[model samples]
Target: MNVSLLLILLLVGAIVTYLAGDKLASKVALFFGLASLGCTIVLLNHYNLGENISFITRWITQPNVSFALKADGLSLAMVLLTTALTPIIIFSSFGNEYKNSKAFYALILFMSFAMTGTFLASDGLLYYIFWELALIPIYFIALIWGNGDAEDRKKAVVKFFIYTLAGSLFMLVAFVYLYLKAGSFLIEDLYKLNLSSSEQLWIFLAFFLAYAIKIPLIPFHTWQANVYQKAPTVGTMLLSGIMLKMGLYSVIRWQLPLAPLAAKEYLPVLIGIGIAGVIYGSIVALRQKDLKKLLAYSSLAHVGLISAGTYTLTLDGLRGSVLQMIAHGFVVVGLFFVAEIIFRRYETRTIAEMGGIRAQTPKFTSLFLLLVLASVALPTTFNFVGEFTVLYSLSQINVWFAVLGGTTIILGAYYMLKMFQYTMLGETNKRIFADVTANEGITLVLIVAVLFFFGLYPKPIIDLITPSLEEILTQINRIN
Candidate 1:
């Protein structure tokens, strides 16, 4: 019944899967992933029934730290997203064989465990620990099993690692300063602080430095494309699907709540930056020949819109951001898998090298088209719901913001369709482009089903996340 059980399941799963050997590793990893999903569902039921699911115990009394895990609707929703996607990402890698399958699969589970903990931890110090822990597995995943030349992959992975780790230290310093003032590292305790405007601004900027690089907003995003282009498809999926959400999620969970005034003071600039990223990402994506690089830039754009929505500090904005986060997570993963599918067949990610795939693999072409449409935020797809709400929120803040941000859909459609036309249409490729296997089809189907179903009826998610967003808003407005 405790929230920690979710973390335990993922961690235990990682250990057991690692020990299970290469032959059984993938299966065991999938089993644990599904089990974690089940556990999250059960926790959701318990939370709905008004039971105490959050767990807290003192871990380091000196610094006032605790091993605490909170399962509010917001955290639970994120945990659900992590658990649900972990298995899908794991399962999608079935077609490719790695040299050390056990280690590869184990790192996936371990990363999931760290990410789940990051979502659930209620104590600031504990949250930071989980946040940093999530970085290690992904670093190894991209460095060891990643694609491209050894020196190139090493440079890309190392640059990403150093870039993110350096940004995180600023966050750690902020936490240390906050702990000094508040004498506690618990979220509620930190929220109670009534710091000066300048103090709050400094704290806010420090956190922003970390989140910006992680979310890779604008200039901070220099490391993103290289890393995404070089990482293995599974590594790419984890980064785009779930890891980047950590930065967006932290904006809500940590930055704004901790420094509401700073968020308010810098709202326009922050939103402008996000909108800029949207336009930038879309335009960059349009020119990329490599499919993974295109998708990576495409992610930068989608998340930029999501970030702008979150910075708006309205319920609709927050709700839209959360919805988009979930929608984007599923859809992006599906899209990357589509890229991987083509790579598996063609042995290349170059868009020009691919063509007439539609004539060869009707089923894959159909699913890939659906994912492309979803990326463009087409109506009756899950992405549409989030995109609409986000735009609406921006319009409320300033019509200009909405106008600028709306370009994502238009620009998104242009690039996505062009990529599709070049990669999937035209004369048949001389190489044999096989139809999707059952595993691949199942993954795309599951992703599409969730997107479309939620697109039609988004109320459940809206309802689930509203109260939590409202509380965060309350904390935000308490001083303002």
Candidate 2:
């Protein structure tokens, strides 16, 4: 089957989940989510067999945009990430009840559909459309179902919406300008343009504005911690787990290749900003009182490193970024779900209020400790594999960059381990904290298994993504 089937499956799934009624919506969404994962595995098999799976059809004649979906190793790896994590995110919400559950579940599926399309779309205009489409579901999801003071949540979500939208407009302008010059909005056509240095600089900066906001790098990341705390746990999981990766992926797929010279010229500046974000996010995370907000800043630190590695424009940088993207997705989701589990038992997000959970729930404490370890990039975890490579890439650029970026590991362990001591150790809490339920256990176990399995033997993934990274690296160096 062609890649369009993947989008069709999720889009149709959204509609079906909504119509299935509130009582059945979660189950329906899960079914479709698993089906999408299975379909991706099948497609990956076909891709490995050297079969053509990308789909394209003309959609606009005047502006030369096409309804296109391209499935190469890079896009497919991301697509797989979206599909694989979606079901886990959905299932993790099983224990919690929501008002208008059907609409909530439907929106979750719809967001998945949009993100998948963003990863696969080949036409710049189409990719931009899919990219913007993703913002809609999360907006409503956070606004309606989110926690905290209604007014506060509204302000946070709206601010996030505006920041990302304004940044994205710059990117749309860049694409439109490229279309005018090349008479086409397909990625290949835009990449072929031999623009002057000035033109490439503007385009690169425009795209960087869009991506940096979405990735929520330093200064641009003001909206992140508040929104993550305000949104419901499910929404937070989707945002941290898969949505932000869209920005990092675009940096590799769209930004650099389209403006290779600009990317090269600004390499030091870009990497500097990224490393700054790493130091900044980690320091901020160490001071957070709210569990979700801490995780949010932690996310910022990790993505910052990923962005820095990508800006290095080396194959190792690209590959490490991609690997870290996937590893971070799984680990962040697990960590957020851990926060949710704690909130369910204690009915609070304050780390100060939580304590002595290890006395009551050994299973949960063990699992939570595992997630924390993974987040800190412990050896034999998938995060370690990715972080090591990213640091190596930075060292290749400049040893000092590696030295600064490595602060994430040191600061990460300190904050995370310290948070664990306060939240799970110390005097026994007066309130009861039950062990994880079967559903919760399943979700945590699945994520942990994937992290460890890949950590020890990352060759398969390394092999899968290497060739595509090589191509992007070639494009990056083409103008040099």
Candidate 3:
């Protein structure tokens, strides 16, 4: 089977669900999500060793871009993450009642469609189209269904849309230049282009504006927390869980390999910015009173380390970046879902307003605690494996750099534990705290199980991603 089916299912599912009316929208979306995931798993499992999952068709003439969807080892892992998480993201929202269920579910599926296409597109211009396509559904989702003041929500979402799209404008510029130079929008064609140092620098900076803003590194991060805090839980999950990874994935796939010399030249600056984000995000998180806002900053800090690992240009760093990307995706989704659960009960985001959650809902407390520990990169959690490797990669770059970047581990624990203590461990709330519902319990359990299973044995992921990473490195080395 080809990779195109996976995306076709999501796009078709969106339209089908939109037509199904409110009664069956969520179910249709969930079914389609699962079908895509199931199909992906089967395709991945049945493939002979070294065989690629790919399909290419003529889609354009002037730009010479083809409808090429190829899932190499790297893309497969990303697609797997996107598909697997889509069902979970949808299922996590089953308990909530949106105003228009059909429309909301359709946006989610459309998002899945754009995101899957983002991962699978082997054509650079096609990838850019998919990249921009992802922003639309999310923009509508956040604007229409989000919580908070209408004007404030508009401000936040507009800022988010404009900020990300502005960054992407520069990226589009870079792609147009690459197409002009390479004469094709194919990934390999762009990769084969040999530009002068000046050209690489401009292209790298253009690409950097897009990815760094998406990753929301340091100074470019002003849009992140506000957007996360304003968006619905589902929107936040889509943004954090996989959308952010699009930026990181682009670094490996587009930035570093395309502008190898520029990336190497800017290594110190990028690592510094990444570490600054860790420190900056952690400090802000400690001061956050809103649970969603806190989680948003926490994401900033965690991804900072992953960003640092990525820019290091070492094998350990690259692999660790992917591993951490996966780990953070799951953990952030669980954490934000917890925030939603609490909001459903309390109707508040202020942490000070929450206390003694555990005294009432012991099941939720336990699950929340496990997720917190996992976020802090506690031992035997997948987060630990990812964090440790990323930090080790940093250490290889510079011991002091690792020391600075490593502060997130300490700072994360401090804020997360502080958050837990204030929110979950204080005097019991007067309101009735019901135990975990079946759907919520199942979601949390599944999340924890993955964090556990992978924490112990990350060999499969490591092995799966190593060959692709090696090829990327070889590409970089050849450029060198």
Candidate 2 structure quality by residue, lDDT tens digits, 131-155 = 9999999999999999999999999
Higher-ranked by lDDT: 1 or 3: 1
Query: What are the per-residue Cα lDDT tens digits for candidate 1 across 61-120?
Result: 787899988889898889989999999999999999988899999999999999999999
| Candidate 3 TM-score over all chains jointly | 0.99
lDDT of each: 0.94, 0.94, 0.91
Lowest-sum lDDT 10-residue window in model 3? 43-52
Cα error, residue 252 of model 1, in Å, equals: 0.4
Q: Write the per-residue lDDT of candidate 3 for residues 291-363, one digit (tens) a residue.
A: 9999999999999999999999999999999999999999999999999999988899899999988889888
Estimated TM-score for each candidate: 0.99, 0.99, 0.99
Return the clash pairs for model 3, or none: none
Colliding residue pairs in candidate 2: none
In model 1, the worst 10-residue window by lDDT is 1-10
In candidate 1, the residue pairs with backbone N, CA or C atoms under 3 Å apart (3 or more residues apart, or in different chains) clash, namely none
